[model samples]
Target: MAEPQAEVDPKTTEEMEVPSSDPPENDNDQDAETPKKEKDAKSFDLGDLVWAKMSSFPAWPGRIVKPWKNVKKPAGKKAVRFVFFFGTEDHAWVKEESLKHYEENKATLSKAGKGAKFTKAIDAIEEAIVKNQASKSDMESNEQSVGTPAEGQTTSPYHPPSDDDDDDDDIFLKSISKPTKDYSREPMAGKKKLNSSQSASSPGSSPRKGSNSSSPFTKINTPLASPKKRGRPFKTLEDGEVAKKPTPKKRPSTGASTAAPGKKARSDMSFLSLNLYNSFQAHLAQKGETAKKDIKPTEKKIGFIGLGLMGTGMAMNLIKAGHDVTVWNRTSEKCEEFVKAGASQAETVSDLVSSCDITFSMVSDSEAVRAIVFGENGVLDGISDGKAFVDMSTVDIGTVTGVAEAVQARDGRFLEAPVCGSVQPAMEGSLIIIAAGDKELFDECESCFQSMGKKAFYLTDTGNAARMKLVINMIIGSVMCSFAEGMALADKSGLSQSVLLDILNLGSIANPLISGKGKAILANKYPPAFPLKYQQKDLKLALAMSEQVDQPLPVSSAVNEQYKRAKNMGLGDKDTSAIYKSLTH
Candidate 1:
């Protein structure tokens, strides 16, 4: 060490100081430093975006307004607080622990281009507030000097006079006394006096002060400038009087009123008058004497066949829409109710098809639909070019395709429109109609569809609508079976059936069908809104169609077996929810 050591510089040795054996401590310095460190640890800067919580509200995005402290608190218990602003006018004072920096990944500081603009504007406003406060204080201090009155003036309107009894009495007398001269009686020098009768008749009439004669209240003998007339000028006689009657020059009829000569008809009239005029024209039309241009052509005649549960409501809606509807049913009695509701009764299906521009059929099954279309005196026999046939029945794809081909072969248009709702939706005009084949025919029948359904979807191929219906029905059947199985399992587990339904309603699988059917199943009441047998038929058709395309539907096949079991148990006429009863019993 001695060999390695080099000579130390005197200036470097003087810079180094030796430590004291016992360091002198100042409590004031240590205490002040501790507080500063704590305050710096808890402080947040202005304009910093943070997440803050209010007393009862959830944590929301906010920005720190300022560092605040409760001065009234005891010294040691006192802690720094933050003033936070949520939006333009909402602010809260919260603890330091209640606020944190906003995570950038979770949320941005603010919307784009808005944060910077808001901060700059807020800073300007705060500066203006400080300046205004200072100006207010200065003005208040100068108020006493500015408010002092000048010599020979009173601060208030009223001033107490010198102590003089005579002066006070004179002021009082003058304030109470009326004027000596009456202005109403005094007339201006140039104005003429109005007659007593004229003055008495015109309550507000008075002479003009300085004019020669012109006054709205003055009665002058001078003739007035005539008013500018609108529209055509009236013909006058040689004596400058209006003519009693106009010359008979022919005027073209314009379906408007004509005023007599020298008289103007009012332009404003109530809507009742217009409605009555329209009614009179309609009456003339019915008599075949109205103007050709004013007459409305008759509505197209619409025909409805197979007035079953669904078809009856559909036909009624068409009649309600003001179509000239003709309805036919196999039972013949079913048409009576519709006939009473403004629909004409047809003795045969052929008569209905022949008379109507468009004919709609909604039968039970493929067999019934085939009989109604291809049988003698059926739709095929009556259809001609320009005629349209729409089948609203749910049937197999092959059946609908066959009917569509037969219809087109006879020079008639065909549309396969199977609806996806039950009797209630049909009655309410809220059915979902799936239509395919003949785009022009679909467009032509759109108005009729609107009257009977909520929405109509047009598929391009003939069999697509039938396929869609089958697929939807298959899903509906599967869902109902699953609902039933869940209900059975819940019951076996001794859980409340109603609570299970409520829980399901709160979850993802909740739907209108499930809610309605679950309630019905719980009550052990299955009325036939949709019969079980129909659901079974749709499932069978769906399975058969799936096999044709080599696609397997295991879930649908299982649901179909459950529906079959329910049907075999004599619940076929009950609602589709009856499958729940099969599992329970």
Candidate 2:
């Protein structure tokens, strides 16, 4: 299929040699690479903001430029548009259906995008587009000055449809002797030009100060790019660079690589080797892409709900690890801290859920979790296919299962990942994550889990992780209560509470909870880490679960009463270690 000519402004410096959009053909040529969608089909013209995707490649940002006509195509194939890729300075012919509207794919593209490559691609493409528009305005002014074209030539034959298109990475290369633009940071001007007589290793190897020289691997006889093979590759030259001519060699009897009598054969001499295209692929991949951003695709577009002490620390860890974190809180002011720390603020749970790939919520009790996930403008309101919702709140198994079922019913995924360890561990990125439900979603969250926690266990069932979380918190409450009792008893006996803490923390039974909370008790500073009420709530939930399972917990039963006494004493809002105050009061 031959491509048609494109109209130009003749004012912009950057010339985009692209093809115009072809008319939709009545053929069954749509491959698995792109599915046919009559509803999405719309007309498009030159210079539109469209996304283009090719077979087996990630989507790339590009715009339609002027078309070079008469490019023949295979029979029974769909029409294609010439797409000039953003930063790579590459071009390709893309199918009409393969294009998506930029707005339609913006969030998905942003999630797919990262690194210097994606950023620079979009930035440079946008700059070019702005300049192109400015140049168009200039051309219109000139047209008025010079009198218009013949009356019939006023409207372009290829007028763009609606503001819509698609995206992909179907990049193809056309060989040229020189690059129109240099991709490197340094300007490709004013460098020493090498002569044919210069030897590769004749002079001394040490470089002079302040000299910028490329590595030998990057400096080859041909250009630092992959060009299509006709017979041999086309010669390309960088600024101040030379393409050396290879001396002809006689054919070998075994048909091995060709080499001049006294010269080493460059691996390139064997273009017909078994892995020729594979080698080109590897080289092109390195040449085209810059390094990745700290946040890879797996960890992009993370939504965090709740900004309480534990949520604050965990969400901060995600941000610090370079994930794109969007946070929402009941109190808008609480989100400001996260916003200042390079996180986006979502106004509602639905907004966060709809915009983000995976939303993780860590809030107060079951009521709070239920309220945020089920109320007006809540998580369910934004539930869509492929969205993931993970509740890290300390809710009971019944609550977890209910949320999970509701999410899955609405075509969204759900996971229960209740964490162990309090504010200190959360802030330090060492919380233990107990995860279950939707194994695939759990796997997708691996990078995020690693960022906010030291260890993560996949318990493989919806309520299993919540049960584990309850068990862990119940033990935490019981142990802390026991520790408080011991410290209070030691103080009364004059055995030195500090000494008791040191000995207990160093013994086989020593733990961070005992050591840290013991210090808090000694200082008589009852700031909340794991608040007494939440601990008591966890105990209360555990007892309820025990009742469901028909189990007896005499020690936990007694411990729950102690926490209740503390709660009634107005110590519920204080740290779990505040249980010591019940005995003293």
Candidate 3:
């Protein structure tokens, strides 16, 4: 199941608190700690322990993972900040009173019982003072040995710490690790019993009085607080995993249709019901604009053909945006799906051509598109001098140019709008629409396309859309193939398939495709989100296009071979990630 997600808010990490020993009336202290003067502080202060008030509740301790004073900035400003490793987000601001000089502070405090309490308390106090002094000495040494900044002046705010600092190699080597909570996943059912009793008794809820005891700000117990029951638990990416981009949401029905021509759609499918009412109301409002040439509605009628995965989604948006739509598909079955959902279906290409103000085509490929639009019974037979036709198919640049010429010969306007995305993007109305051809036709169709997609880019020529589609798909193929190779190598190195996935998930190198499809690949689930055969076809086309342009595409060539092999093995209809299985075999 896809994880539940919340809109991410940017969080600013809080700086660690610095203890001050100045008198309460020392108004000059603020000026003394000028951002510049603070930069000049060469030694760490060993002043009396002063606690900063907590900003938030349920106090949790932040480990002073690395602390520095008089840290020379690249621009020569001295900073006296420390980096703290907090286990949870809640207690990031709450500073602790001095008691945390050592791990034994708690044990020493526990011994303060009856007659032994006096001596024990004295010992604890002395230890804390001694540790504080030692820390001060170390700080002084660090300041004296500070190195010069990389540049005399800095342009950016963030810079690396100087090498004079301790050689804690782990600090540099460690990846930014979040806990392994899948934030996208929905919470599991069933309420968990809260540790209400323990929490009520815990000092985390209350401040300790008097003695320098950091009892309220205690270490967090990682195991108990997780895994969170709702939403994806934040999991740290492994060293090399790439960050995954969120998948776009499916487009809202908005009272549109999902009914296919002949299939009985679910009763809950309201697209048809709502859109039907809308279509009737819209039809009435337009009055004589139905077929009359003189009276045009606010939005002109746009003809759309090939109501498959891509076309149907785009057409629905066009209708939903209040455009008068006349749709046609070679397969009469496909047209019925839209027709039943309130879109009027054109029974023949001539009818769509003669009637449509502007038409968009999203057929399977170049051949089908050519046949539908230029054949004996094609759109051209009925197309007039000023008609506009937009083709949104991934086809050869040559084919696009050919279609452009043919449509223009008939005196009709033409636009090639091969989109750069898949089913999910199309469904989500987030597909990137790339257009080429007559500028006027593009402008005319712009609003209708916007209703179907998030972005649209117009190219100077008609074939650029085809070229861009090839470029984008080439990258997709290479990335998927590269991931497959990496997974295969990891599996062969003795890691379980699941463990390999986990490592990838934790690393910065993991891509969204891997995490989203990793489990399915492991379980051998090959439901075609994007068909394997179609991917192979695109790879072949991309490589062939590369060769035609005198471009060297060795990486794409190799990936294409992999997909071809997978196709040959009869995995063509499965998901593209099935390439991993082919590699293993």
lDDT of each: 0.53, 0.55, 0.48
What TM value does model 3 have?
0.49
Q: Write the per-residue lDDT of candidate 1 for residues 434-495, one digit (tens) a residue.
A: 99999988887877887776689998989999999889888888888898899999999999
Off by over 4 Å in 3: 1-298, 499-511
In angstroms, how far off is 302's CA in candidate 1? 0.5
TM for every model, in the order presented, reads 0.49, 0.50, 0.49
Which regions of candidate 2 are displaced past 4 Å?
1-299
* Poorest 10 consecutive residues by lDDT, candidate 1: 179-188
Residue 63 in model 3: lDDT: 29
Local accuracy of candidate 3 as per-residue lDDT tens digits, 221-304:
111101111112123212232223221112212212332354322211111112222222232233432211222233767788
* Evaluation by lDDT, superior candidate among 2 and 3: 2
Candidate ordering by lDDT (highest first): 2, 1, 3
User: Which tens-of-lDDT digit does each residue in 1-585 have in candidate 2?
Assistant: 001111111111112211124443222122222335742463544555567754433566776543322122223345555555554423445666677756567778745654444575677556555545555676687764323222112211221111111100100111111111100000111112211011111001111122353111010011111222211322321112211322111112111222235432122111111112222233334456221235443645889886654675577668766788888755333343355446766656787788889999887677767777777778999889999999887787878899999999999999998877665455445677889999988889988888776678999978999887788778877888887888888889979887887788679986556666676677565545466777888899999989998999999999999999989866665567789989875
